[model samples]
Target: MPVVKEAPLLDGSAGRLVRLYTVSGGRTRPTASLDLLTLVVATGSEPPPRSGPEHAQAMGLCRGPISVAEIAAHLGVPVTVAKIVLSDLVDCGAVAARPPDSFDHPTDRSLLEAVLDGLRRQL
Candidate 1:
């Protein structure tokens, strides 16, 4: 297993900022269109030779489909940072991304009720 570097907190600290910058290769924006709800999965392709540790770690987490928000949480990095890393993997064909399903009627009462019922059942 490749060693993944610990993600630094985005606490407005200089050292943390530097590490984050390093992780993203100084790129502030991702080329791929991604959101918190976007689902990413491993494509079973190896990362490029020059890929960073974050790429490897992200790939490991992506053995199954996982949301971008979950990836950020697991990686201990900010959502933006996760997006950057995921975008790179996407560009390299090492990972595949699925946009979140769109709901035609987001305000449907039945949907809300179903969600509430599911939550209640969990509790």
Candidate 2:
């Protein structure tokens, strides 16, 4: 069997990807930031034809509710770098980001009581 080899770590690749990304207007909207826990979903089957390779890969990976952290891991780059790439996609509407669900409101008293009841029973 042919020997399998792992892909090299980001190292120079990250810098190169980042440089190209910035040159391609990835930083046009500096205000764009993605939460590490935010869920990303691909809005289209693929990224725009002219998009960079990294953007295309990211768009392809976001077919489901994948977290930003997971995307970074899969891309073999740092989370910060992934955020930059993903932020660009967000700006272009190629991907949709869903904020993490928050339970601060507690609108349903019944649901809250049920959770409390379950916890008490487990104790």
The estimated TM-scores of all candidates read 0.72, 0.58
Report the lDDT tens digits of candidate 1 across residue range 40-108. Answer: 999988889888777778999999999999999988789999999999999989999987665333577
- TM-score of candidate 1 relative to the true fold: 0.72
Residue pairs of candidate 1 with colliding backbone atoms? none
Best by lDDT: 1
Poorest lDDT segment (10 consecutive residues) of candidate 1:
9-18
Question: Model 2 compared with the native: what TM-score?
Answer: 0.58
Reference-based lDDT, each prediction = 0.87, 0.73
Tell me the spans in candidate 2 whose CA falls farther than 4 Å from its real position.
1-30, 102-123
How would you encode candidate 2's per-residue C-alpha lDDT over 1-123 as one tens digit per residue? 999884532456454324544533645333465778888898874456776666777887998889999988887666776787788788788888887675334458898899999999999
Q: Candidate 2, which ten residues in sequence have the lowest lDDT sum?
A: 15-24
Cα deviation at 115, candidate 1, in Å, is 7.7
